[model samples]
Target chain A: MTVTASVSTVSSPECGAGRPDGEYILIPAFNEAGKIGEVIAGLSACGYTRVVVVDDGSRDDTAGRARRAGAVVLRHPINCGVGAATATGLAYLSNVGAVAAATFDADGQHDPRDLAAVFAPIYDDGADVVIGSRMLNPEGMPRVRRIAQRLASWSTFLLFGQWSTDSQSGLKAFSRRAIGTIQLKTNRYEVCSEIIAEIRRRKLVMREVPVRAIYTAYSLSKGQGFTVGLKTLARLFIDRILHW
Target chain B: MHPIQWIMLVFAAIAEIAVVAGFRRGKIAAKGIFFWTVLWLLVGLVAVWPDSTYIFARWAGITRGADLVLYLGFLAVFFLLFRHTLRMEKIERDLAALVRVLALRDAPEQTNQPRADGDK
Candidate 1:
């Protein structure tokens, strides 16, 4: 399917005044057609006027749905993985001169209300990166997920020499400097760890904010399973060796 | 010569002929042709004269010529596999970069414009 560049503007008079200037919400979605529209609508309800969704060559109508829901949709020609999608979103944001940007999941797991807390450190404290930590408010979070997150955090710390409370959090904010400074090479879930490593390498200030994770059956199913987690770790190790 | 030696010699001759054919078809460069030619010639010589392998094996401090050949063959396979892996990774990275460029170039002109539904 040929997806041409099209932007659908969502004009909400009531929420217009609350829109944050020069700040965009970047969502990397793959086959999230069932929930992508609602995710975009939720952002619209939250007074966020700038939303960019990178459809990572989904087999469904995710790109069309996102465009119709008032998001600037960037469609990959092939499935390049979530990391590639995020990098594409960031590159587009940088090209458009976004001052700050937040990466949010399209699976409807992340709350739009937490956007403020995620962007707070970037705008107020001059933080280069702000991570929305689910561990800070783990209420309703699955025990298995929590343990997996802890293991990932420890792995990130050991490999990158940078400790993050939630290393794999999808909800994170990046200032313009952070967006430009951090170079992402991984094309999968491993990009999360690569970002943390970039934070240490580039001397970027990072802060973690308390954010609630709304985990539904759908969201839980969409998350990385045990096998996927192992693959990600293996890829991370291979990447390290290859680049080293 | 032993039956195994005769088999080895025939295989080496076939490989040499294939290499020459590849070079004639312009699929192999001059340097590649030279390298493969030398390699196959060495293989044919060792197969015809089994004692030649022992002399090299003794120089390399390997007791058996067959053992030395086995070690060298394993090393060559590993080196080729490593090179292939690196090339594949480079291709992956390049493909991703191309995809990103295409996505960005095809992006809407006004990315930050407000939508009619109050979304950007």
Candidate 2:
């Protein structure tokens, strides 16, 4: 891909040449002190120096670890769920004039190597929103998670008439325009479907990129169980009715 | 009408009148107050003539008028509870958002602070 000169002007020269202007990698963390530092370091090594970590009320030293690893840490006084953390990070990025932002999971499940591919479309201004879809390859993804994600994707399609292979993927990249226009209200996992709804509602161009999710015992344990999935479904239904 | 039924009817009538009077003095919307007053008066009439419920229930394919009222009441209560839960969720989300803003705004940049439990 040919690097656009305008895009080159906005990226940090120290990280990688031609990185999007005001681009930042956002990680919303909760009690992942053990993994937060590695997540930040991985991004930095990828030539993406602009990193922001929203420590979602972790009782551990997640905030301190992230800061030490060269990340701008934003702390939430209490756990506000992943959705709220992502929103806080996005709000901060927008305030700081970020041209694009990518949200990465802090559970050590995501690969930092995919950051460049995820942000490529946004950097080239080819898409307004890019979602990382594990279903594209489904390698290393647990069977339960794969099933849950498919069900969630089907439900999201039913609600928003837009479908993605992985609607529940924790990784997504948003252009500056998408960040400024898409306002998220749901503060939990339901916010993932809400984003799809917003993309449909605002008619924003969305692209799904094939990405690998390395689901280990720790990451698998942190996923939404059956009960949480039910609650999420209920909330989404209520929100849909209210919007109607 | 039976004596007991008459007493119940009179009590319901009085209660409706009081409610209407309170609505007039309260800040409730005029349209809502009027609707409630009319509903209460109708309810009073039904209470006085319990037999009417049987007729209505039969028309609605229910076994008894009392059963119809019970089912409707349950439905109303469930609807109200659902709405209340939604409202409460909204308030909680708003509070979280406020707290998040405050936290971010007051984020500590001091990296030299000693870890109370290092590598524990």
Largest TM-score belongs to which candidate? 1
Cα shift from native, residue A53, model 1 (Å):
0.8
TM-score of chain A of each: 0.92, 0.90
Give the interface-residue alpha carbon RMSD of model 2: 7.5
Q: Candidate 1: which stretches are off by over 4 Å? A: A1-17, B16-46, B49-72, B114-120
- Local accuracy of candidate 1 as per-residue lDDT tens digits, B1-120: 899989989999999999999999999899989988988888889889878889889999999998988898899789889878777878887899999999988988855554626432
List of clashing residue pairs for candidate 2: A10-A21
lDDT of 2 by residue, A131-171 (tens): 88888768777787889899999998898777777889888
After superposition, the stretches of candidate 2 with alpha carbons farther than 4 Å from their true spots are A1-21, B1-49, B107-120
lDDT assessment of candidate 1: 0.85
Cα displacement (Å) at residue A5, model 1? 38
User: What TM value does chain A in model 1 reach?
Assistant: 0.92
